[model samples]
Target: MTEPATRVIVVTVFVIGALTGCSRRDRGQREVIQNKGSDTLVNVAQAWAEKYKEVDPTVAVAVTGGGSGTGISALL
Candidate 1:
């Protein structure tokens, strides 16, 4: 993989890991990670979410795509 892509992935994973440690689920709530955008990434995102469930079933990652613009808008 390219250096930039690897860097981005690493950063994303780090963020996710950090989030896992501090979640609302322990207080009787669901832990959710919203992943939006990138049609090309939707497949991989879904796969990652499914596999992550095995690794950490307490957290749920909801992945969806509606073009990059849609995602950015949603974030706003």
Candidate 2:
């Protein structure tokens, strides 16, 4: 409703949509996108991941949350 809330939703949607294209696969392996971060975003992220699976059944989106610290560590 608020401008900032709308912005966050838009950005989150864009990032998730972008990530669908970034999934990596190995020989004979299925595609997976690991989305981890922000406890505040956990519910929304999980919902998106589920919906995305419906759109593209070939790829799996794994969403996890443990705050930004955990996400940063996972990234490195």
Using lDDT as the measure, the top candidate is 2
Task: Give the residue spans of candidate 1 off by over 4 A.
Answer: 1-25
| Candidate 1: residue pairs that collide | none
What lDDT tens digits, residue by residue, belong to model 2 across residues 1-76?
9999999999999999999978666767778899998999999999999999999998999999999998999999
Off by more than 4 A, model 2: 1-28
Residue 24 shift from truth in candidate 1, angstroms: 6.1
Report the C-alpha displacement of residue 40, candidate 1, in angstroms. Answer: 1.2
lDDT of 1 by residue, 1-76 (tens): 9999999999999999988968444576778899998898899999999999999998999999888997898889
The per-residue C-alpha lDDT of model 1 at residue 2 equals: 100
| Each model's backbone clash number | 0, 0
- Which residue pairs does candidate 2 place in steric collision? none
TM-score to true structure, per model:
0.63, 0.62
Q: Looking at model 1, which ten-residue stretch has the lowest summed lDDT?
A: 21-30
lDDT of 2 at 43: 100
